[model samples]
Target chain A: MTRRSISLLGVLAASWWIAAPTGWTHRLDECLQAMRVNVATDRLTLDLDLTPGASVAGQVLALLDLDADGEISATESVDYARRLLRDVAVTLDGRGLSLHVVSADASPLAHLKSGDGRLRIRAHAGWDALGTGTHVLDLTNRHLPSISVYLVNATKPADPALLLGRQVRNPHQSEYRLEFTITRQDATDPSPP
Target chain B: MAVWLWASLLGVVPVLRAAESAAVRVTQAADAFVRTLNESQRRGVQFEFNDAAQRTRWSNLPVSMAKRAGLRLGDLTAEQRAAAMNLLRAALSERGYEKILGIVQSDEVLRRQGNSTVPFGQDEFFISFMGKPSVSAPWMLQFGGHHLALNLTMAGDQGVLTPSLIAVQPAMFEWNGKTVRPMGRETDKALALVQSLDATQRKAAVLAFEMRDLALGPGHDGETIAPEGVQVATFSAAQRQLLLELVAEWSGIIHDAAAQRKLKEIESKLDQTWFAWSGPLEAGKAYFRVQGPTLIIEYAPQRLGGDVTMHIHSMVRDPTNDYGKQFLP
Candidate 1:
């Protein structure tokens, strides 16, 4: 082969080689998108959408490797898990919401389980005032290295204007973004039914 | 030149791949232990697997016998409980496994002492394994219920099993007219190590203020203070041995080879570390502390249940490795 043709072939092969992993990863993204949160309630749910074929325990180990140490022993795993679960970010209309995350195997207030080929996460959000106005409930997954959130509001709102939220999901990392808007029955009313 | 670079890169890949394989093996061993459990014992293992959901609410401690076990032993059938214990034995050292059983039996002793109703005191033992048991990946073996919390982590070439919070109330209870001191020996060794230090070393080691417990609890962020107070080099030979003994009590919790490597790392830094104590050394009063390079051990004796001098709290931590130091970079 001519030198010019040989060089061109090498360039093409290198480009394909680098592009292969990204293409494969895109398929993984498609699999995760199938596990988005389509249901809504007064209580917020944060689903840990594991990648296709990824074991729940394995995914947890990967998330626990916050240091990207390539390996996570028992001590590091628990510490990372504790820190990740403890530091989860929950915001309501730009204000930080106080909530607890427990083991799915733990209490009736919070439920955790794996079914339908995904690790289902359900958590309750408490509010002191439920006024007849739009309120935003935002949840973020701080642990997963590369996963985006696709949120759908299962609870119908009184008005579309109350849907004051945006979807800013980032794939290739574990930060799923979702927002919920709660509208009161009346704009001036302080009570919520 | 290009060929050489590629060759070197390829050479490194196997090393990395081999390490990953080793990690998988470790995980499989842990999995084997889990797999051996009957549905009931498996349930006990599952109860403490705190995922994102359960952490959101204030859950109560395991109050009932069934709840405490997280799985009823009766439900396991005799064969399953034996299998579960065997799995534990396989995963831990003879000493390590025995210590766990001893601690569990000790908890039973405390429970039988009529101290069951007290809130925030010693109760049942809860065990959870995080990460698959493997030599390569990180994993944890945690056994803690009520006043006892043992957290051990094994990573590549290093293991940290500390912040081991062990507490015993009414330190000694009369069981069939015999005084039983379940957690006394470990405490006494630690206290003796502190007392062996010279006046100058003692002055440097003892914190000006006594702490009820190690300030670095589970959720605390960042290193609280620079390595200060007493240095191990200041101790005499006998005192240093005592210090090593004190640290070993916690290191002994893990049965893995990595535990010995961790002990050696702590031992090599013996001279640079410090041993400190607080409170009164007497049996009735609360007081004790030990600090070293890569190690911190603390103990406090307190009153519980109508002025009974029975409550105790102790903890061990690695200065450089707590929580994997994951916060860095």
Candidate 2:
């Protein structure tokens, strides 16, 4: 995208990480994390996108290349994939449930100065047999320690209502709690998703 | 209760003038550092104290997470670096300055460890000023980066250095010729003090669960937690002395005179101090807290990655006077 296209986003000057305790952080280095709850497949797709500054590109590389070699291997990708599992928390109602990664994969981070700001990692996750109704979903995400705000978005039967509370809860890091209720649009019709 | 809290925190309110008299040296040093900067650099180095966002915008986080301002040390020339250090020297004790350097050195070690590709070098830290420096007026010197933050607030001659966090990732490393542990003294002294507790004191002091992190950190200014631990009244005289020394280590982060002023204030209400602990009594993976009418200190061992006790985070704050509120309206 051209600088004009970037300007169209309505963000003047530079952007800040919305999730920061002080709400002060640059946009380029921040990773965009969104969660989409699916009624069609009883699954959630977690997408994490990062465009690191030249200074922070190396950290993304290290996460991809656990062995520190120039090239990323399948095993290293799997390792990075597993790390995502540990960082995110998904719960139905108030009860915490383990989320099984349906599939884990990553594309290599681009050049540090690349204004393209390509997607760093895309993860597709599924939770089977989730009943459909007006049920509450609480998302507690801790995937990126380097990230201040998770920028969590939840959508299911409809673009569900969301409530969020953020704090520096664990160690010196920030944790975000996003609570929302997803209702099957056709509540009159009982459905199993 | 409010009087005791303020008395413990702003004890230096009375001695502010005395400290200010000695602190003439610091104000002069700050002026000298300012002279070294050009117009553009000066604009970058200072902010109004009331920019509540800017005043609290500091963390033990990387540049990606924690945004900082002012002249970065990495970009400074040798002359400029010396000037900056000179200003810091005026603000911190001879040893306190070394501790800051030590924390910086540990960052370099973590960078070499190469856990992530992000920049974690000593140069990542930033320095900025809150308001202009005047002997009688209120101003603050805010400096920090990964694993370290120093907030020194000045009024008259009195100063409060609470609400600063000093921490390290590798916590232990080999620096220069010797093995360096930046947080060693705090860990060691705290451990010794807890061990010295007798059975009765231990029962009162130890909490049931582990304290995972600091209850009061950045953006948590002006908050308080109920004291839960063995009261200072329960300790013997020598044990009390040990406790005072531990508190001194945290307060001593500032220059000798300022640290002394703060320490003496805390000592006056020494009987009101409380010591608390959580997690296993074993040396590693434990959390400890010290609370009094005016002071709050916390040390938590983080379980980042596979290493449970390898990384440490700690903070010191004055609930009543964070960011020099005791000196302000």
TM-score of chain B of each: 0.71, 0.91
Candidate 1 chain B lowest-lDDT run of ten: B53-62
TM-score of each: 0.49, 0.62
Top DockQ: which candidate number?
2
Error of 1 at B7 (Å): 26
Model 2: lDDT to the true structure: 0.66
Which window of ten consecutive residues has the lowest lDDT sum in model 1 chain A? Answer: A107-116
lDDT of 2 by residue, A81-137 (tens): 667667777665566666554444444434333222323344544455444434444
